[model samples]
Target: MSSTTPQASTTTDARRSFLSGFGKFTLSATAVALLAGRDRLALVGSAEAKTAGNDVTILNAALAAEQEAIAAYQVGATSGLLQKPVLDLAVQFQGHHKEHATALATTVKKLGGTPVAAKAKYTFPVEKLKTQADVLGFAAELERGAVSAYLGAIPILDDRELAKVAASILGDEAMHWAVLRQALGQPPVPSAFVS
Candidate 1:
């Protein structure tokens, strides 16, 4: 024979095999990332995964909202618009937000889901926040939103332990709300409660 050449059919089969192996590897890597809670890109890569369930979606949403509060409080504490007392309290609220986020992530992991990442951007509802009073008012509103969201989640959570944790966090959020209101010159207790 003058010359011998590899069959085109063999080369095509090898290419297909390599592509199949790569597909499997990609799928495996994605699964591992989702399990490790590092695949928010992959988890949210599919809009279907993002809207899969009410409880899981709500937990993800709450994590985002709590993280927003934590970031806002941190900014307020360092912005010099707040007095030391307000700054200190803002730090405390930031701690609570972290705790809440940790608890939610733990629960989500235990339930065989990945915790959503905190959003890098958030919009605070405080067009009037210009002074210390305004900052405290903004904090109070954030806490109120957290408390209400937790209360709403309590009944929806299928896990009893998760519900209890939400209840505990709700109590802390309520306390933060009360403290913020007090610092903003409102009575510590509702006027109707004591009178």
Candidate 2:
């Protein structure tokens, strides 16, 4: 009976260890699946479906904001107010907005939704671009708007990965705003916190 007791104890320990290892493996596999774009909630297909729908709506709104930013930059770049160097910078900022739009569109499609297209004509203050200062001021306002939109999106997005993406874009938009503000002879860091 003494030998049997030791054997039983060893068997129980081995079983516990096996369960621990198996649980770790399962968790790791789930993480990998999520990173690979497999929606875990979609596997069950009920509650998560609604969350996915909400995510699609938020992502489409973000895409539209990006499109608007791109249009604003295009107007500023072509207004004949910016010098060569400033125009180059405007184009660069526009490219960033385009990249954001592309990523948002891709994510929207991945969520089974169509992206909102840019309007045929956006009502930007094109007539207000009378000088370099005016152009920079307009671009700065648009960048600030982009920053606000992305900042708002970070909390609304259901997916952590999507929130991370929005945070990244927020950083980029904030930088654009700061630079444009400096160009407009305003304090770049207007406040300690952007809130």
Candidate 3:
């Protein structure tokens, strides 16, 4: 994805216009991904009934986190505090989140469980931000949480195929964190991610 350089002076009209367009673009992209996801699941055979419920529960938790990541990106994209490039990156990350959510939801359905719909309201680790830096910081944090969540689930999953899927998605989440860090002008990978 290409990044746009921030304009010399961003006006209220410019920010509003960009946000409106961005929202429409994101919603459309999410819809397409969901449709593709349903198609993909039709090809995979169902797992054993005994293990299916456990797999579905784990996947549902990950799906919830993916939904939260999507929400976080939406906030960053429409906040108007970020430059176009940064906002575009936020949208890109949101797209990945949607893909992950769809992939997991597909898995849950294949396993014979109802896919959980993410809550409309979620609690973000980062509170309201007073500056652009704060927003990017929150984005980075969300990506990291997603990365950890996927990694933790990968090892415990009984299904090897789903484990592979989680591995791939976790890798993408790691990349999202790096991109978010770069956007914030922080080290792409921190020396120590946590204390």
Candidate 4:
């Protein structure tokens, strides 16, 4: 009777060990299956997955913004409201924007994406360019918008190189905004930190 009792106990212990291992294996397989399903769903839900991420998308967006800035500066330069000095500055700023656009286009092409072309005309407040103040104000606002866009791009870019490029462009755009603000009789250094 004692031997029979030990045999029963050993059999119960072996059964428990096998069942415990099987339970763990089942849980692991289930977790893996769930994770795979989630990944598939994410892949099916967006074009981002099709592109293998947003690097090219981000670059193309930046390129488009640069094209818009170039067009805006062209309009401002031709408006005749700016004095000689201001017009020269606008031309210089426009050149800088062109350079940025070229760089962005090159990068986009290198990344296997198409660079966005400039539109024949952009929809700006052409009717409001009656005075120098209006022109300067519009230019300043456009610079501010460019600065904001580049600032926003810096952190969201996944590649460190692309982020650095964005930061460089951000600094230039911020400088342009500050100069425009100063020209508009506003303080050049409005705040210690640019938002």
Candidate 5:
């Protein structure tokens, strides 16, 4: 939504605070993206092993967020509020979230941690989603929160290479947000900073 939704705004605010202390842990990526460029992410150092437990916690949190995004897209796709083109875009965005979830789960397992499973339901504002624009607005709000979440986490990652991988994913999420805004006849990227 051009004017932020309550849920998305709250999540973004909370994540901003959580990500401020993100340096306490680190992520070590090994090919997190599959969009292009082979998505190669190598550990720059062995320091991450010492903080694997904390890393797992953070990764699981991000995984949970991505899963939520996937579920949100599913809700939008099946709401019968979107046209053919919009529905196709919603599906494609869901696929991206699935890829993100897969990569997060893979990394969590590599760190000897269990991935966080998706919940049976997420509290979406279904009553507010009455039109195609309403659905797009809901999705845009989620994407904006996602972009802010990833952006807030990227700078604080202890591993530079891991941050690089995260930046790539952040770029993808930013694109998703921008596209949703454009589809809603709003500015694609309203500001340089996600917040």
Candidate 6:
């Protein structure tokens, strides 16, 4: 993406940070690739390779990002720039982000870690959202970033179930990105690969 949206790089960097957060027990990229819509999910012995403590930290970071996505959607939903149909889509997408956050937070608690709290405010390019198309373009950029983030997590996930979850989330975010791009009169899928 262009510099008009800095969140793209930030989101990718944020997701990549989870790689190092593995700490003492890093996952092997060759161990898994649980993309959604595939029935090839098989049990892996690498589940034991990850420590729950480090998972909590990594999950917290993802939780924080999800919370921010929720907030970003809220901003767009109430910006008065989106039409009725677009507002409806924004609200629906926000709900998905909330669901994502819930899942991450629940997992964090299950792992005996405190989930990150949402900030009272978030930073967004509000001034650039002068038109409905601008808002949609901004949202598309964000969804693209989310797709990258979740896609980055898949191969490095130690647990097969977690890898599946990551891939499923990646698929959802990818669809959101595609829909947003389509709404903006752009190609839904610019390339075969997301990155």
Candidate number of the best TM-score: 2
TM per prediction = 0.67, 0.78, 0.72, 0.72, 0.75, 0.73
lDDT by residue (tens digit), candidate 1, 68-88: 776677556654678786677
Q: Which lDDT tens digits does candidate 4 get at residues 61-177?
A: 888888778667666666667888998898788767776776676566555567777665557767767788887888888888888888777777765666766777888888998
Worst lDDT 10-window in candidate 6: 30-39
lDDT of 5 by residue, 31-145 (tens): 6332222222233345555466566777787899998887677677666778989888987787777777777787777666789987755677777788999999988888888
Which pairs of residues clash in candidate 2, taking residues 3 or more apart in a chain or in different chains?
A: none
Write down the lDDT of every candidate, Cα atoms only: 0.63, 0.72, 0.68, 0.68, 0.71, 0.69
Candidate 2: lDDT of 54?
Answer: 88
Off by over 4 Å in 5: 1-48
For residues 129-193, write the lDDT of model 6, one tens digit per residue. Answer: 78999989988888898888877766665556666676777788899999999999999889987
lDDT of 2 at 67: 80
Backbone clashes, each candidate: 0, 0, 0, 0, 0, 0
**Model 3, 7-35: lDDT tens per residue?**
32334665465456435543234334444
Error of 5 at 144 (Å): 0.6
Native-referenced Cα lDDT, model 1? 0.63
After best superposition, candidate 2 residue 110: deviation in angstroms?
A: 0.4
TM-score, prediction 6:
0.73
Candidates in order: C-alpha RMSD to true structure: 19.5, 22.8, 8.5, 29.2, 10.5, 11.2
